[model samples]
Target: MSLVSKFATVGGATLISRIFGFGREMLMASALGVGPVADAFNLAFRFPNLFRRLFAEGAFNAAFIPLFARALEEDGEEGAKRFASEIFSTLFSVLVVLTALAMIFMPALVTTIIAPGLAVCVDDPAAGGNALSCAMRFEITVTFSRIMFPYLACMSLMAMVCGILNAYRRFFAAAAAPTLLNFILIGVISYALWIEADKATIGFLMSWGVLVAGIAQLAMVTLAMRLAGFSVALKRPRWTKGLKRLLVLAGPAALIGGITQINLFVGQAIASFKPGAVSILQYADRPYQLPLGMVGVAIGVVLLPELARSLKAGRLAEAQHTQNRSLEFALFLTVPAAVALFIIPEPIIRVIYERGAFDPSATPAVAAVLGIYALGLPAFVMMKVFSPGYFAREDTKSPMIVTLVSAGINIVLSLVLFPILAEQGIAWATTLSGWLNAVLLFLGLWRKGLWEIDGKLVKRSLLVLVSALLMGGALIAMMWELNAWLQPGDAVTTQIAAIAILVAVAMAIYFALTLLTGAADRTMVMRLVKRKRG
Candidate 1:
């Protein structure tokens, strides 16, 4: 498939997943908001969710995709399938052990790393509010964490299946699988709400929903593999040559993949000290993640395998074109999203989340954090586009070192900023660290002469920025025009209409300027679409 087609396929599926994710979050806002139960749910979910992203989405794919793609290219189908099976066996064994051990020591993990402040709140009888309630919250968090930990194991295996499918050029099934999680969560949460279950009971049900979703996603992708004519069967663990090499690549990649998660860990740890900070960050984070996941994940998934294929075949120019275009595409989409979020965060937050327990008082804090996170959106998406250059060549150590430094910077900054700016400081730290990582990755790529932006790409990128700024200006003006309708006391319909108008206007202005300034590649997009349809 053409790059655009591949992106569209993955992007289309991701859009669905992101939409479902937004629905899930909207429900969460209404159901939990920023209360104690919400805090508990966020903390509990972050535990397994962190590891799942770190290993499944980050490390496993970084190491697995290039190697697996190369295997399929160089080896016959049998050889590739054999390699996949062996790697799967070893990975499953390891994840099983890790999940078991973590579950056994769930309490310690909660106290030491996940939510230290919750533990503090529980231990200090003199602390204000209900000590019993605080203790119950900690206990529920631990229970939910234990319930959700197995999801990491399932999802890591699911990611392996996805790597296999992506290498085989079967993108839709893998890309579509994540939406199942949202669907399941929405159902579980909605059902809980309909039955009027208590918050703790509802939290437990949602925790189980995570596991169910993991299982469903795994099954869906596993079936995709079989239908694609790939048999990825389990066998006794084997320490094969490919497995050893995978581990070598994965060692650094594990750290590289964990960088974002580690930053999140830092933010969550700091936020846990202040009640409701976790949920506030989570709510603020949800909207930004829509663009990030849609642009970043789609680009990352499609680009990595393509780069691996091109580089393995010694198509240096093709590899460079792929990198440049991917970067261009990311910026083209992400810049406007970042601008919009930065300019009108309050109305967006209020419209999407200011209902039920998410009162008007919560809007400003979440909006502030959302705006800060907006600054980092491009960097985060750029990292997704840039890191594949190193991974495709099996040179993970460079990105790993850069990720370690970026993570350290995030932690130190979060600590320093949390006291001064609260959760918004953590958001700033994430944004700054993302830029650090993106810059370092580019520097490494430059030093190695692996890639460079052509003059045209740079010019167009500048045009993209200019267009986005114009759109931002237009959006800000419209926001001013709709100020009364955008306020908290306005009817929900009015608030929604104001946001819809602002976004529609912003998009129209941005795209019109992009075409007029020659920032967009209309002919290329049309050709890709024609070829895809043909």
Candidate 2:
């Protein structure tokens, strides 16, 4: 299959998952709003999610895929399976211990890292609010976190299996697995709402749903692995040469892979000082995550394996072209997405989240956060594109160093800005830090002569930006023209239709401009589609 076609397979699945994710978030917004229970649930989920991203998706995949590809190239499927089994046994043992300890110390983890602000509000009289309420929220967060912590083990194992699948060019099951989480959550929330459950009850139900979803996701991917004629048997964990090397690379790749999550961790910690801030930022995050997951994630997943195979086969030019095209594809989609979000964040947020307990008053804050996040959207995607260049070469250290610097900057900025602009400040800090990470990754690849900016890429990138801006301008005019129909008080169907019209118009303009100006390669896209069909 062609590279773009592979990307489409993953991207298409991710798009479905993200759509369901939107449904989950929208339900949560109605059920919990930005209240204390919402804060508690979001904080609790973020805790395990943070670790899941760092260990499972980020570090494990970055360190594992290249080595797996090499094993397949050199020693065939048997060698790869042996390597995977060893790592699986070791990872399972470590995760068991980690999850056990984490649950045992759940309160400390909640108070210290997950939501320190809640702890302070509870203990410090000077901080002065409802201490009883704060303590309750704190306990709820701890309980919810403990319930969801086991999810980390499930997802981490799933990610390893998915890495194996991706290396084998089996993208659908892995890409589609995330939808199970959203599906389960949507059902849980729907039931909670149907029964008129209170906020605390809803939160508990959702946490348990997360654990169940993780298990389901793992089972789905594992079944896919077996069906693909690959299996990793349980074995005694050992310190083999391959295991030692994976650990060495994974340690650095953890930091490099989870930079975005790390920044979110920092932002969440800081935002916890204020009630509703965490939920607000999260609500804002969902809209942008759609594009990032569909485009950036698909590119990252597809590109890393492609680059590894190319480089392993001693095809430097093919690797370069892969990186360049991935970058082009990421920017082409994300730049326009960023433009749309920046232009119409309020309408989007309102349509998605303004009903039920989600007050109309909260729209402006969420919209502001979404707009700032939109500014960083392309950077986030670019980081995904460029980091694969380093990882495919089995060099995780360079990106690790870059990620650390970017994360540090994010910390400093968040600390400085949160006091001033509230959640929007955290949004800005994340955006700036993201751009820095993307730029450094690209420069690192270029300096090492691993990647070169071809003229086509350069030209196409500028034109993509121009097309996106033109779309943004048209959106601005449309918003003004349709102000009455897009209002919060308008009928839900009317508001949705208005947003839909705006999006349809925006897509039409952006695609037309890209096609007419040659920013997007129509012939290449057509050939990819035909090849996939063939």
**Candidate 2 displacement at residue 3 in angstroms:** 0.9
All predictions: root-mean-square deviation over Cα?
A: 1.5, 1.3
Q: Where in model 1 is the C-alpha error above 4 Å?
A: 127-129, 525-534
TM-score of 2: 0.98
* Worst ten in a row by lDDT for model 1: 125-134
Clashing pairs in 2: none
Count clashing pairs, candidate 2.
0
Which candidate's lDDT is highest?
2
* lDDT against the true structure, each candidate: 0.89, 0.92
lDDT of model 1 at position 420: 93
Write the residue-wise lDDT of candidate 2 on 1-534 in tens digits.
888889899999999999999999999999999989999988988888888889889987799999999989998999999999999999999999999999999989988999888889988947966878888889899999999999999999999999999999999999999999999999999999999999999999999999999999999999999999999988999999999999888998988888888999889988999999999999999998999999988998999999899988888898888888888999999999999999889988988998888999999999999999999999999988888888887898889999999999999999999999999999999999999999999889889888888999999999999999999999999999999998778998999999999999999999999999999998996776797899
